[model samples]
Target: MTRIAACQLAPVPDGLAANAELTADAVREALAQGADVVILPQLVTTGGVLEDAEQARAVAVASGHGVFAAWAAACTARQGSVVVGGFCEAGDDGQLYNSAAVVDATGLRAVYRCAHLWDRERVVFAAGSAPPPVVDTAHGRIGVLVNYDLRFPEWTRTAALAGADLLAVPVAWPAAQPGEGGGPDGQLVAAATARLERVAVACADRSGPGWTAGSCIVSASGQLLAAAGPGRSAAWADVDPEASRDKLVAGSSDLWLDRRPELYDRLTAPRSTSG
Candidate 1:
């Protein structure tokens, strides 16, 4: 009976106060709507794809300064509620990472950094070492993947293999151009891709002119259970971990069950230039 909400709302650029308010509002709404876990999009506190110079290097608050802290405290106050959201993590070594924190009413649960940095992000954020997948509270083995992380199937595959029942993605996906008209693929591709592993993939993507419009949830066999409206809304859905597991156990796919790593190694063998 764990219902997670993937919020799709407009978070103003560099507007921490506004973002915090928005996050609190969403958390409240999710709880009111009977959500056990409420997942927010990446950079929920600080707007992503920073454009302004001053905004580009915005420092991360110490689990106390801004929205991240505010959200954490709010979640803790909610008793049974938990929150998973992203923000820039300021490390003790003085490095800022593109990171996400899994929090509950008690405070921080797990902090995951983005291992794969996309386009402009590499220039501003330091990467984190990819850690072995771990379950958060045993309700289900949870794993985190930032936006660009979804492009690589192995990332999701490894998590599934490592016992992740729910693969959560937080993204600030971009809206297709004025006329290009290819609606967001976060869900379409994730669901299609997850069909390979037969795992549930849930994503909280941003909306409006700054980010992609669609936020969605995919079933264990890649079925679209729910989708957010175009731009600024929450996508609500119920994910039965048991059902996801059941589908994987019953479904047939070459994803992990029929892997032939040995053959792949030879197939992808590098060729020598010295012929």
Candidate 2:
């Protein structure tokens, strides 16, 4: 079993210094509390929403090295723990991408660029071209996702098919939206996905003016193992990736082995509006 910590952070807009300090502090606290891995919210270095694209682009950091190196060093000194968190990334082509980096005592291991953008994010940040990578760690084989990516089932399935045991999601979900005004919280979506993929999920959501602070950890059976509310909060869970190997929901109903991929060809075909 891996001890997981989901940290709910409130990042100040454009305040990289304050945000970084808070994130580092949270990691230390979680480790002290016996957590083997810690997950933080998306765009944590620069808050969720941005006023100006140029200013947002300025706060983007490299995938690894620098601040990440410092975090790795701290982890190494503390007997080695895994840290997964999101940040604004300065891409090579002079654009910005919402990126999540994985670090441990061995230093930076993997980075997942957010492939899906929501609302005004499309105007400010470029959608990543690469898919989320399943990375190996001391705790387990971890996959990663950003805020809007959770709405896509295909993406999560891709991660599961890639042999990921845990999915680390960093999100900045709004408090309320236009259509579905009142219903289950954002974490429910995560819970359902965890059940469908049969993998543990750790979601770290932000808490601020326009965001929801529902941070949670779900078990492979789609159970809500731990959760937290607004402000700076942390949720803990003990997960075993091996539990997801049992794909049988009932007698002869295997999850992966019973797939009908031949009939789902239309899912990948181009759509037409005139139909």
Candidate 3:
């Protein structure tokens, strides 16, 4: 059983130094609770929503930023422990990106830039062309995804196909409006995605104005293992990453073997105006 902790935090807007210490402390606290995988909210190093491109670029840091090093240091407290969290990245290409980094005691393993931009994000950060990366860690194979990336099933499927045992999502989900209906709940999406891909999912969400503080962990079987309700908190769960390797959903019904990829050509095709 691999213990996972999804931390819900309220990051100070544009406060890099403050958020760095806050997130690092959260990681240490999660580690002390015997968590093998510790996940933090999106843009944890710079808060959830930035005012504009200028503000975002002001706080953007490179992948080699000391904030990731702090997370790496926290992982050293627990053997084989891994941490996944989001940050505003100053890409080497001289562009800003909403990105997430996978770090462990060995240091930063992979950094995935968010491919699908959310509202106002497209104006601030460049969308990543690369697919979500699956990092092989001591505990398990972990995949990284940022906030809006979770809304795209194809993107999450891409991660699962890459043999990710667990999907670590760092998000700053918007709060549901009054009378809202038919909208995707972050927790519900996590559960459905786990069921569809047969992979465990952990989502760490941030809290503040216009944000939902819903952090949760789901099992490979689509069960809601644990949840951190409103406010800053941490959700804990013990899941079996190995269970994802079993593609058998039922007798002779393999999730992977039963795929009809040949018919999925349209999934990558250009959008059509009609039909």
lDDT of each: 0.71, 0.83, 0.89
**Best-matching candidate per TM-score:** 3
lDDT of 2 by residue, 144-180 (tens): 9898898889899988878789999988777774125
Q: What lDDT does model 2 reach?
A: 0.83
Reference-based TM-score, model 3:
0.95
Per-residue lDDT of candidate 3, residues 48-138 (tens digit) = 5787889999999999899999999999999999999999999999999999999999889999999999988988999999999999987
Residue 75, candidate 2: alpha-carbon lDDT? 80
Residue 160, candidate 3: Cα error in Å is 0.6
Which scores better on TM-score, 2 or 3?
3
| TM-score of each candidate structure, all chains considered together | 0.84, 0.92, 0.95
When sorted by lDDT, best at the front, the candidate numbers are 3, 2, 1
Runs off by more than 4 Å, candidate 2: 77-80, 177-184
- Order the candidates by TM-score, highest first — what do you get? 3, 2, 1
Q: Compared to the true structure, candidate 1 yields what TM-score?
A: 0.84
- RMSD in Å for model 3: 2.0
lDDT of 1 by residue, 1-275 (tens): 45778888777777777788988888877877777777788877776566532455574645545565566667654566777787766677677677777776666777788888888888777887876244565346567777787877767776777767778888777765322324566667778766876777878888777566577777776788888857547777777676556533435753455677677665446876894
Give the total clashing residue pairs for model 2.
0
Worst 10 residues of 1 by lDDT: 176-185
